[model samples]
Target: MSTPTGFMEYKRQLPVDRDPIERVKDWEEFHKLLSEDELRTQGARCMDCGTPYCHTGIDMTGGTSGCPVHNLIPEWNNLVYRGLWREALERLHKTNNFPEFTGRICPAPCEGSCTVGLIDQPVTIKSIEQAIVDKGFEEGWIVPTPPEKRTGKRVAVVGSGPAGLAAAAQLNKAGHSVTVFERSDRIGGLLMYGIPSMKLDKKIVQRRVDLLAAEGVEFVTNTEIGKDIPAKQLVDEYDAVVLCGGATKPREFNIEGSNLKGVHYAMDFLTGTIKSLLDSNLEDGNYISAKDKHVIVIGGGDTGSDCVATSLRHGCRSVTQFGTHQKAPLTRDPINNPWPQFPNVYTLDYAQEEAKAIFGEDPREFSIMTTKFVGDDEGNLKELHTVQIQRKVDENGRKSYEPIPGTERVFKADMALIAIGFDGPEQTLAQQLGLETDRRSNVKAKYGQYRTNVDKVFAAGDMRRGQSLVVWAINEGREAAREVDKYLMGSTVLV
Candidate 1:
């Protein structure tokens, strides 16, 4: 543990962003890393409590918190503070296969439980975490190491997202010949395209994909197993099949003019933008553009935030976000969300901050719903009709939302991006494979074990757990890998 008084001495110092105004001009990461000396000072602030919540990772639901992959937070922080960076890298790799991605974009829930945070600010754990992995790459410590021997067991992983990648990496380490099939044109599923290059650069994603390939994982892109190839073939050919496909089908709004032009699902806009960037040409009108238009994004999740940030980068004339729920409290409330649990409260994200900076006021409207979309004669959306509402959970545990009287209003918009979240994974592959899915459309797999109804077939990620953060996806992938490894080998040594 660092000195008790050190927490009081340190001011929770960290790096600063490169001017939000300048950053909004392009699709690039804004926050810069602190120097090694500065990182050490921040690391020294860790109290390393005897019952370290940061490492405990215990959530309210009996699930652990520190890290889903169980990265050694305390040990790595101490190693980093002592400048034992190589050792810190080793500790980080003990659990996570790709800290680089998580370090860049994860919400940093671990830092919230930092003992130092009880009084003053929390340690800059996320930035320090990012720095450790970055140093690992700079030192050329990250390289491909194919398993020493083949188990003669072939495994087919049905997704190229983080979950599939983690599963494949571990199964390969188990000496199984691993083959990953991606329906998209490129590997890395949502990582390759669903995420903006600014937040997660394509190069960073590709670097990991390349490493996996060199590690003897076969990647066959542009092949939808249910469409391009038969699902039965995967079962017959491979020793086992692991379904890591993500929940992709977007939840649609049941408002009027739902089929109008200039309206698109959030994934369509995000994925299309990435494809345009990949081709090095945004001139073909393939990418969704919000430039010179009033953009309205419905939903208050991270995806909606991304749409706002992306639209801002496209030079959108104006942007507004509408949320169905009332604004949450700024501070922790035990009755609503107990401490040590994720503080279910209101907070500002990067995009909202950027929007506030540009727009004179924050662009978010809480407890609001779009009544309908108004479109032009060209069948393109022109405006949105909205109303402020109150949401109350009923006795039966159902949610009911009703518009407040006299709160009706209309907002001008040329394009509307529905960011309400995902419904589930596309059903084509599941149906073709004859796998059973729950009513919510998620693949029916018992948590932790990840085995689907189909024999020797498993599911993970958003497909199994529904849409969630990349961190959770990593957790699902890692846990599923353990199960798959055990299923194949009858026992396993994987952590």
Candidate 2:
């Protein structure tokens, strides 16, 4: 609370993003940094409330209320306001292992719960967080500071997503020898491929990975625990094993013509595009290109938006996204959706902004359901059929969508992408280890206690909790590391 009137004195501000039309020409990060003075002004807006719900990290009304990682928000904000960049970065790293990742991609549930947001826009927490870390890197203050001594205890971390990376970082910091196993050819699971480079540049992910590697975290790529090697091998070799394999099974629609040539899962398309771009800058022709094609993306989540943006970047003839739910209200409903809960409001995401720039209107069609895919004689997708839908809630509290009468429509689509989300972690590793799974097919492990049925093994992240935010994954990984440390050394210092 250095500036008692800061929240009222300064107005909320954010950096202007790269022009949508211009940024769509290449696969690069679109975000820009605010000036140091402007960022300080934004940081000053932090009310630093007594409760400080911004970092409470609570779940309310089936939505995240604050930062899942429980970052020291006010502390860092105050530090940044005082122009103590290094101190702010240090405080940020105290809780969040990778502020760069979360700052850029996270939806920032913390801002929704900010005390200042009750009256005006919330403090620019995400932007200030990013600037702090980016400044640290620029000043060469962030470097590989490996553990001073090793415990000689080897730990195996499965998966290399945010969760796995966070776990490995913490375990290494605890002086344990940690090895991360990633099935992909690369280190980052979702951050490297599942996300488009335009949102999260792969270089940023690799930069952190390089630092982790230098910090004595061994990384083993192109090897899977269950398939490439027996899951028991890690159990026998390592003192402890932590499973951070994310929920990777994408949900699919088994509708008619789903097996057509142009039909593909959203991850497959996104992964291929990113891989191709990274490998040869799209010269290899190894990915499914949307060049000069009519692209229809199903679902309305972030993944779907990425698909739309990717298609536009590939020079698609046209693009449209479908969502079963209606558009969100422009403003929050105070009664049903009160303060501190994630506001269900409408705003133009980056992808939609790009689509509108080119197509003259928003590319999403809400309250629509895909019925079937129609293909030509060559088995190539030509068009798709859909129907307008209305959501209905039964008296028992079950919700369903019903088709509207005489509202069927058809649209030309050279390619169709399914991005409805994911189910849970793949089942092979769990079955191999004889681990128990919950009804959701996620590994049966309690939240704080990440141990599975198998002895000397732990599960965390999407593998244990099902598909969720990357921030939640990081939180799970950190907590799981603490539990693993306790199980190994009989006491733990990890926070």
Candidate 3:
């Protein structure tokens, strides 16, 4: 701890945001960079707890927590505090393959479980972590460290999402020959298309993917197992197989008129737009654009928020979001979601704030559930029928819902986006492999082990655990790689 004396003296400081009102008008990251001096002060604020929960990456139940990738938080915090920037980055990279992605998009449970947060503000962990990774990129300290040796073992990673990439990175480091297969024309899966460039620039993903390629990771685009390439062929050619195809089965609404022309899945709109933007040959004109249209988004999750933001960019006449649950309190509710756990609370994201600033009110309508989609005779969605509902716990402690009286109403909607969530991984690959799946159709693999019933067939990320954050995918990838390595060598040193 280089600045222990300044621990209590220095307060937590996060990077300042650009003026929200102005920043929302464009597709760019709102958070500004903190100077080296500012970052040093923030790092110095870390109490660096004797029992640091931030880096444990495990919960009270002895399972994963805080950070899924299990980053060495204290070591990096200390390294940053001491101004040993390069060493600090090395420590950060020891566990995390892509701090840059997690740095920007991760919800940062590590901060929630932070020891300093018990009384005072958390030790600016997320901010400092972001600074460290970005600094490494800026200083060119981050490089392609290709393996000096290659193990003869061959591996095929299905799906080029975060998990597949992370697993490939680690396994390749261990000298195993690795190749990633992606059905999409371009690689990076969700990162390349699903996520908007405003939140995460696709070029940033491409940069990292390029570096991984230089380090000897082979990426095969437009190739999908059970389709373009047979599942049996991969199993025959490789010693091990990793499934990171991701949970692509979108959750559907049971409401009427869901099949209307103007109604679309959140991924369809977001992914379509990004693909067109990135690929000149691809035409996004076919995408569902809300320009001059009234937009209604179902669900209050990140995907719904993305819908709202994208609609605004498309120059929608008006935008509104419907959440089937009550609005959460702005402040943390320890009684509901306690400390050392992911605190449950309401937070204003960029999309909500953007809609609020533009529409003169928050776009969200909590406790409002869409009953049906009203559509024109031409099969185009025109409006949404919804009602407010109340939730109550039954005698069995199971909560249920009921619509409130006099709450039925109609909202104008030229376009509707369903963003409830994903259900499971698509069926093609799973069925082809004849792999066992849980009730949700997610590949059946215990969280830590990430091994499927089929020997040498491993699964990780959303494909195994259902939809989740990118950080968790990275964790699943690393852990699965460890298990795969062990299976091949009779023992492994991946962790």
Candidate 4:
């Protein structure tokens, strides 16, 4: 346990982030690391509750309440508090294959379920996790450990995202010759292109990928199964195959003028920007430029916030985000959202914070729905028609939205991004393999078993489930690897 009276001595504190104005000027991570002494104090704040719900890894109220990867939160917190940084790193790596990734991008449901959070604030678990891994790297403690004995079995992972990467890492550790096939030009799938550099540095993703390669995980990029490489070839060539292809099919907004030139999906816009930045530092003229334009992002989720931030970096003249639902409360509603459940609270993300700092107002407009997109004769998006809506809850608690009459208005927009969400994994590969799909269009596989109808074929991550957090992907990937190992060797040693 952490210091018995530590919670009373220290309060929850996070490292100060770089100023929003300065951070928006470049595509680099904005958060600064805390001093070791300060971080140790933060770790000491962990109460080390008898029931550590922070690592419970369970679902509550239709959302995850704790660390999806089941990270040993208390163990690591105690280690860090005692100034045993290396031990903390070891405990962190036991469950999570990529603490660096989660520590950077995850929304930290673990903190929401923290025992201390029921009263005041939660321990800085996410920050401490990052600190441990980063310090391990800096101290030259983290190194590649290749498997000694080869099982002579071969495995193939379809995607290079978090799930696929986790599965590949675990399978390779179990002495199976692993080959990861990526459809994109780079090895890290969404990590390489989908997310912006400012949030998760591309170098950090590549660093881990390179380490995996050193540990003998072969990577083949720019190849797609069922297209460039046939599905039959992979099944026949490998003893087992794990499908981690994420849900890439973007949910479309079927409004008028959606096909206009200035209108694009959020992924396309984000991916293009990152790719261009990687290739020619934006000189290639490949990415959609939001510079000097009145940008309108349709959707108020994290993706929409990303669009707003990206547009701000591009020096957009004006920006606005529309949400279909009403804003959540600033604080948790105890009766509706009790303790140990993921809080449904209104908070500004990095992009929105930057937008607010620059524009002197939050960019989000809640309970507003876009009805149509208007464009000029040259096929350029120019305006958006939207309506304000009021939510109505019936006696049975079924809620619906009613558009208020005379609330329709036109807003000028030179560029519009659709940031709605995803439906499921791309169906091309699933159809080619004849894999069964759930009603939600996700690959049909039991959560723990992770096996498909086809033998030697398993699924995990966003492809198996629908869109989910990166931490959940890691969990699914690790679990799927255990099942795959059992199938391959008739028994397994994977955890």
Candidate 5:
């Protein structure tokens, strides 16, 4: 342990975020970094328990318990505490391919499972992680170190998201030639467009892409497999193919008047705004506008919150988010939600924080479900019908949302954004390659093996495992690369 009583002596602290109201006016990252002395003190707060659960990386009760990437949390914390920052960055790179991304956006399940969290707050792990990598970059310690030799093996990676990028990076490190194919006009699939800029700046995504390119990983954008190029052609040409094209099909909210003019999927709205911002700083006026309009975002989680923030940035007259679940209590329920499992509690995320700062209250409506879209004669959305719901369990142990009588309500809305979630990946490529898929429409592949039914083909990340965090995607990608390397060389040195 760095210090015997460090945990007791130093209470957990995180850098204060930029003023939410001021940050909403521009599209930039809102987080600030703590000074070196403060960061070292925060790192010292790690208990470094003999039985640390922070890096266990297990699932419990349908939620993650620890870091999915299995980060060496304790070791890095000690290193940072000792002022060995470069060493801390090196240890961080051992597992995570993109700490900068995860440190910024990941939910930090690791903190929930921390030994210290059983008593006080957990170590500032996520912030320390970001600081380590960011410091590495600023000090010029991170650079492109291409393989000393090439193995003469060629690998094709589908999708340029977290999984695909990590797979490509690992495969290239093993001296394999990697070509990443992305359908979008740029690399970093979800990282580039799906998320808003305020959350993850695009430059961070591009910097990593440039490093991968320098390390001899080729990236091909604007070309989709199974469409612009034949999926079979890749299977035939490359030594091996790894699919990481993520679960992209947004779940449909089919209700009365669902096809109204002002109703759209959450991804569509987010993607358009980002693309426009990157292309011309919104000067082209090619994206959705919520200005001077009352907007309603259906569903909750990060996407719904992002919609709320984006609408606020557009100067929306008012915004409200509808969530299917009840309002979470301020603290975890010990009996139902035990210590190790991620705490299901009420906390304002960045977007909601911005909304509250601007509107004087959080704009989330819990335990509500939208019923139908009330539209005008021109089929333009005007409002949405909703009813409060309560959770009920039947004799069979199946759960259902039961509507409560006399709780029906309607809210005026000029635009409605569906941000529920995704179904699975689009099936065109899988169908074209004659690959099997699970019932969920994810590519059929064993979790550890990542091998599809087809020979020399593998799937990883959300495409194989369904929608999940970026850390899990990186984990699957790294593992899948190892399997691919073994398949190609009849042996493997990758981990």
Candidate 6:
């Protein structure tokens, strides 16, 4: 437990972000770190409730309520508050394999369920977690700890995303020879490309990758499972195979003129920009340039926000974002979305903040839908046709959207990026491996057991559970590794 009077004595505070104008000029992380004294004060704000729902790792109100990885939140918070930084780092690592990644990318459901949040603001759990890990790295505390002896068991992990990496790390700790295969030229699947560098620096991702390599996890990049190597070969060669190739099949718009030259899938644009920037610092001209173009990003999720920010960095002339649903309330609606569950509230994300700073107003427009892409004579996107929508519910409780009459309008756009969410895992490898799929097209695998229909084959992460958070992926990976270890050695000690 932290100081008994800390909650009332101090208020919640977070690290200050860099000036929007200054940060938009380059691809660097925005938030500056809080000083040690301030961090301790934040840590002391933790009440350490008897129930401690912050680490319950459960679902509430159609979304996650707590840390899916079940981190020891209160213990670490107390440790940090007591100035035991090293011990705090160890406690954090007990459950999470990648605190740095989660600290940066995760939406932090743990904070949503914080006991302290029942009345006042939530404790700064995410920032404290990041600070612990960052201090560990600066003081040379994080190092490779290879297994003492090899179990002589071989495991093949398909995909180098969060889940795959977590599974590989755990399996190697249990003395299994682990090999991770990535289709991209570099590892860290989504971490490398799906997310922008400003949000999560590539150097931090690569630093962990390098450490994993030192710990004896083999990485084979630019290798597709069902394409470069046969899926059957992995099952035949390795004692066990774990699939974590993330859900990547983008949902189709199916509207008119979607195939225009200047229109592209959000991942393609994001991946290309990151790859080009990493390879030659954007001098290679290998990515889609939004410079001097009027950009319209369809969909108002994290990806759409990322697109808006990336476009601004590319010097886009103007930007707009479309959302099918209405914007959430500025604060939690007590009657509708009460405490302990993630509040469906409107907040300015990094990109939206930058857009507001540069463009004078927020770039998002809610309760709108893009009807079609209007193309020029050269087959390039010239404009977007959109309409305002209103929700209607049928007697059966099914909901649908209807375009409001007299609200249809056209907006000029030189480039349009679709950031609508993914459907499920790409079916090529799963189909080739003869794995069963759910109605949603996700690979068929039980949650706790993580075993697919096929013998010696297991699945986890987005491939098994559909598109989800990095923390959930890590949880799936850790649990799946334990099950795989038991299946291989008859019993296991992995958690």
TM-score of 4: 0.98
The Cα local distance difference test for each model comes to 0.85, 0.94, 0.85, 0.92, 0.94, 0.94
Error in Å for residue 306 of model 2: 0.5
lDDT of 3 by residue, 423-455 (tens): 999988778878999999999999889989887
Estimate, for each residue in 246-358, the C-alpha lDDT of model 4 and write its tens digit: 99999978988899879989999999999999999888989988999999999888788889989998899999999987789989999989988999898888998999999
Task: Give the range where candidate 3 is weakest over 10 consecutive residues by summed lDDT.
Answer: 56-65
Q: What does candidate 1 score on TM? A: 0.96
By TM-score: ranked, best first: 5, 2, 6, 4, 1, 3
TM-score of each: 0.96, 0.99, 0.95, 0.98, 0.99, 0.99
RMSD, every candidate, angstroms? 1.8, 0.9, 2.1, 1.2, 0.8, 1.0
* Model 4 alpha-carbon miss at residue 148, Å: 0.9
The alpha-carbon lDDT assigned to residue 284 of candidate 4 equals 96
Candidate 2 Cα deviation (angstroms), residue 58:
1.8
Candidate 6 vs. true structure, TM-score: 0.99
Off by over 4 Å in 5: none
Weakest ten-residue segment in model 5 by summed lDDT = 56-65
lDDT of 2 by residue, 210-272 (tens): 999999999999999999999988899999999999999988699999999899999999999
RMSD of model 3 against the true structure:
2.1
Backbone collisions counted per model: 4, 0, 1, 0, 0, 0
Q: On residues 120-149, what C-alpha lDDT tens digit does candidate 1 reach at each position?
A: 777788898899999988999889999999
Supply the TM-score for candidate 3. Answer: 0.95
Tens digit of lDDT per residue, candidate 6, span 173-280?
Answer: 999999999999999999999999999999999999999999999999999999999999989999999999999999998889998989988998999999999999
Clashing pairs in 2: none
